[model samples]
Target: MSTPATSRARGVERIIDIFRQLHAARRPMTMRELIVATGAPRSSIYELVAIFSEAGWLETSGDGSVFFGREMHYFGADYAAHNDLISRAHQSILSLVRKHDETAQLCTLEGNKYTVMLSESSSRPFNISSDIGVKVPIPWTATGRLLLGHLNVNEIRALIPDEDFVLENGTRIAFDDFLRDVQYADAQGYCCTEGLSHTFRLCMAAPIRDRSGVAVAALCFMTSRDTDPKKRELMLDDLIKSAKALSEPYSRL
Candidate 1:
């Protein structure tokens, strides 16, 4: 009962799944492993893998495992080159880290979760850093509050899943408290949280607004929880300034 359009769409979905599986694995996968991971028919997976390999989207190893090819790297490099926001954000985080000697990250909402799009780690031996592209519960991050500041109460409630309210340590955040934090963050133009995601870490975040003044991304720093209060304020002030600079119109850059 599948129409040609539906069939082609399914094929596209399968191709995307193949890449997703490989990325999640972080290594080469054998043909059978790919079939199992994607849940596609063996024959279909074989055909698609063959086509992708020939097109340089995938490459095979001597042991018969397959992984992403050089073409994928080229595509990623091209995207970074052309994306003004990403390119600029990268520079901003690098500068922030160099100045403060702390971990700095560029973050944004991915679906209902917060994700670190780019990160610059501190040179110190002991520092906090998040894995890029890892999806984290929105309620567990200071940037999450800032990112959702533009949303209405009803919209924010509906967007985040109920289970996401629970923290890693089995603590449940009150909805009313979370809403108040979001509003405060919007009004103050910055936010800070201690021991929300990690027991001994402090997070500070500032919004990077688009032309309409809605937060489309965030600039954040993660430091030790025991950092002096005066130091925290200084870093937060610089972070807010940096974020505002990045939020300016692209033509201004």
Candidate 2:
């Protein structure tokens, strides 16, 4: 049987886990939903919420719902600015966007996920949409899969938890299936995805490497599959070239 001290420690861990879920949500979470999602007792969860709210790590709304606080934004932004990989490659990203007339994104490894640090879209309104500062799971995504190709199979498996690949709205390809796709991308020099985001949207991605040839980010081009294949190939070639150019600055930095 566990002692009272041991039980208290478990409760603390459960509370922290709940906080992480809230952060991962990337949006406000109601008190009831948080409790249901965590399977934690309402009273204990509320107590931790109150404590976190007081500490400014969690912010509660008028409806008593909670979300991550301003402190998180400050810390996340500050970290990105100081993160050398992102700071050194901003100009390259800008150049890619200008050349492609589509969306250009820069993502960096953050724990087991890839966080979008910098993104730009061309003024033309042809499939030019992307999110900045969003953290996406590093699987089942064109850019994510290419990034994972940098690591060996065992290393990739160790970094990602078994359940992390499943997303609410995306198809959950088996781990082995995902690995095969990544291997194929590595051989082809780029990754292409169809209907990953929308039924009509297509994405092509290539890995951005560091000095030692480890992938640090992905340079991607987004367009519609309805577009001409020749146009898509043109965009893919442009993206590959841009990634090569982008890698030079970071590789030297």
**What would the per-residue lDDT of candidate 2 be over residues 157-237, giving only the tens digit for each residue?**
898877766754656658898888888887777899877655676878887887777676787776777778887888888
Candidate lDDT values, in order: 0.91, 0.76
lDDT of 1 by residue, 106-157 (tens): 9989899999988999999999978887888999999999989889999999
Deviation from native of the Cα of residue 122 in model 2, angstroms: 4.8
**Which TM-score value belongs to model 2?**
0.72
What stretches of model 1 exceed 4 Å from their correct place?
251-253
Return the number of clashes found in candidate 2: 0
Error of 2 at 24 (Å): 3.9
After superposing candidate 2 on the true structure, give the runs of residues whose Cα lies further than 4 Å from its correct spot: 1-12, 108-118, 121-139, 150-181, 228-234, 248-253
- Cα displacement (angstroms), candidate 2, residue 193, comes to 2.5
